[model samples]
Target: MSERVMSGSVDGLITLEAADALWADLTADSAVPTASGAFTCSPAHARMGYVLLGGHAVTTVSASGGQWSVLEVEVRRAAAALNSVGMDRRDLVRIGPFRGAPRLECDEETPLRWRQRIAGELQEPGGPGLAARRAAGRPYHLAGIDWRQMLVEQTRDRTQRTWWLPRAVVRLLDAAEHAETQWVQTTRTRQAGAAAAGAPAPRPYNEELRGQLYSVLSRKPGTARKVAGWACAVCRTAPAAVLDHCHEHGYVRAPLCQSCNTQERPDHLYSNDIRVANHYTRLFHTDTDDWLRHWHRCPGCRARTTLPLPHLAAWTAHIACRSLRPTHRAPRGRKPCGVLRVSWTGSQNTPRSCLITVAVDCCPSGEHRVLAQVSYREAAERFRVWLAETAPAVAAAAGPDRLDGLPAQLRPVIADTDGEGLALF
Candidate 1:
């Protein structure tokens, strides 16, 4: 027997001619499925059939009575089809009965009352009613015109003749009209209040100071209003919601959507253009010698040293100096006239060593022939010995009153006849 014969077994069930039409429209570009001539009384079956007509496949199914039921499979497929058309179960429930009806009745008495009841249950806040209505394909004369067009017609139609419209559409029209009326009333109320208070009539939004308020809040220029548009300045994609401004300065910054505006706090004063530019210049234009002197202080001896050019080499050189004495050999086999390594007692009460390399004199005209390195103590003792051996010559060379230029470390070793007697040690 055919599926149609089997459908007749269910009582009060109606044939689905509307579903067949939907299926045909949905599969217009592809091979059409063979008509099943299915009939259904259960709301679920009706809903599923309506969805299937929209061209979605059913994947989920349940079986009972020790046998697989084709009805359940068809219902699931119908549901999937409805989902594909963006209509959910709520939408299917609202319009399923109206499908393929002999007459379209949307008057206040019968259909409106029924539509209202369905809308109450289906269009609850956060429900799928709005989404389904939005997805309701192109409207036919039978289904009535689009809701916006219907609202315009309602205003023009003085006869008060009732017309069929989707319940969702009717609700939307009512809401829009209500909001418009409320806005008008609010504007009138504000105007009356201003007049009663002996104040000048309030200016229209266009006549008011455009971006002055925003500029003051954000510490920005009034030109920011020029960038006002649908897209947010920060994120670029989201729609703009408000003019972003500095809360402290009251200057307008830029247009930002709600999400972008609330995502981060305003930047500090140092983040401004002038300060940022100055900082960038200082960072990039700094002298290498200054940086080396500042950072290459010996951790053990507290003496400053020249740092190598490469950062890795500089670090390695620093580490080696901190822990070990220099080998007095020129790096990479570079030859030198002499290498001097001298050890001295540092302020930290530890022995510290330094290395100096001397180059040979190439010019015959030069008088200095040697470079000498000595510790502070050795230099002091040598100065004492030299002063004793050549007292008269030293006195004549330095002049009588000019010994003040002597180093602080060697001054005490030179005895002044006017102050104290010499004690050679």
Candidate 2:
């Protein structure tokens, strides 16, 4: 089994203010920068200040209209921290002695004094004195903005900058939260179900379906196996929710809830147009045509297709001929051609061979004649050549001068037959 390949990096931060700012930027329009530079403070910050902290900030294109509650939770928690710390605007004056004047009535030589004074005024509910005012409390009103209220406001101000975090960091954080929640949900559901039914949980299918799902979700281009793993992990199965099976081809199979499978209608399958649409959109620009061709059979037939999803290159090749009608079947009178034993030079590296066969004549009427005996490799090579020749013309339809940028894996295996774009083997 191939492993999921890492396509990017992960980022983490401890600064509370930074997290708040990032949360704000992502959710709010015309958002300003936070006073501090931290990207992601503690997750706790988001939980406490729900509205002020982590608000709605959708990073994924698909998630744009969806709500991201976890981010909001983190922001609220950050506000809680600010309230606990008692930092406010008035505390700035405590930094200098007399502010360029000869001397001030208060001693401004201590940083601890400033912190304490600031903390006292903000932390306490009411102001007692210069020192008592800095303690944690509700703030007093001034110029339509109470100093204490402003202090509380600043904490939330930082949480709104969601786009401030690096792309990798945002994904990693999102993944972490998703994983944690999924795991918890899966574990709890399985435990409850097992207790209720007195049976153990089912194991993952030994097949590569899990990896295929991951490919659809992840930004990285990948094989079916890699995609399946991520998809499985993201959609924890212990919850007894219906399963959505997606074929490498364009089709997505229906969801089969456990109870529905066992009790209601065992033979029935329910399709989820949303999942299919989502998968199609993700790789639409990447390999639109190929996927349509490869997944020709009904997606429900699990045994026919081993991997859950298809490689972009292979899918691309398949999609080109999806709409073509079959010409004819082999004549019954002809002796059946068995699978050809293909030998090739590149066999050691990729270790794959083409199954070759050709039409032959075995009829007594003398009408049957030996048509050909070409190897599948020859057919494929010829097909590739035809693809290359016609691709330019096809691409030219948009504009005669425009160059077609085909992927390397799809640079059709050309044939030697006059390059007329004909499929001759």
Instruction: Give the alpha carbon lDDT tens digit for every residue of 1-425 in model 2.
Output: 01111111113222233343443443233121222212222112222222221112212111223422223334434434333332223322111111121111221211112223344444446433443244332222211111222232222366431112222222222333333333344555667777897744544433333223322432234332232222222123532233333322322232222322122111101110000112333233343333222221223222222222122212222233223212233576533232111111231112144222222222334343323333334444443444345443322222222223211221112222211111111
| TM-score for all models, in order of appearance | 0.14, 0.21
Best by lDDT: 1
Candidate 1 scores a C-alpha RMSD against the true structure in Å of: 35.6
In candidate 1, position 18 carries an lDDT of 33
Q: Please write out the lDDT profile of model 1 over residues 288-387, one tens digit for every residue.
A: 2222221222111111121111221122222222233222346676332322122222311121332221222322333323233333333333433433
